[model samples]
Target: MIIEIAAQGGFGGITAASLRKTIDVSDQPERMRQDLCDAFEPDQLARLASRPCTNCADRMTYRITVTEDRGTHSFTLREAQIPPEMLDLIDQM
Candidate 1:
């Protein structure tokens, strides 16, 4: 699986940095693909994806993308809106 975290938009129209990491969970007995799907809640992801951007000053926007054998899911949200599970997943990656 591949996990990508990108930070864009900051104070004064500044461009924030981005990061990407690849994790190989193929060795485990349980499929890593299923684990990733579990980690990404579809409802929450839909909400985040459809939510309008406030364009608040100095606020950092975060975009996370997960790629797996099945497909890819991408979500964009503000820094403060990031879910704990997602954060933990990012840390694991």
Candidate 2:
């Protein structure tokens, strides 16, 4: 399955409509949400959702909450204020 969560203006902010493309989300949004989750436990998803606010300054924050039989998990991300040293990497995105 391939799910594409697009951002308007080519970057920043995420909305329900932005996630309008869920081709085959067998285990999606969850799997493709970010690369960091790869190192964490499934239950950790919920903790990420409770992090600091990402929607600062009219920017719409995005958070993913997953609920399983045992419990739930989450993840969130706002505009990438990548450090100057990481500017090159941000440009690629």
Best by TM-score: 1
Error of 2 at 9 (Å): 10
Summing lDDT over every window of 10 consecutive residues in candidate 1, give the lowest-scoring window. 24-33
Per-residue lDDT tens digits for candidate 1, residues 13-85, read: 7665555555554543475555655665545666766766564467666676766676787877775566676
State in Å the error of residue 33, model 2: 11
Clashing pairs in 2: 45-73, 45-74, 46-73, 46-74
**Model 2 alpha-carbon miss at residue 82, Å:** 12
Q: Which stretches of candidate 2 lie over 4 Å from their true place?
A: 1-17, 23-42, 63-93
List TM-score per model, in order: 0.53, 0.31
TM-score of 1: 0.53
lDDT to native, each model: 0.63, 0.36
| Candidate 1 residue-wise lDDT at 83 | 60
lDDT per residue as tens, model 2, 1-93: 232223322333433334322223344356343432332234443344345654355443444443435555544544342223222322332
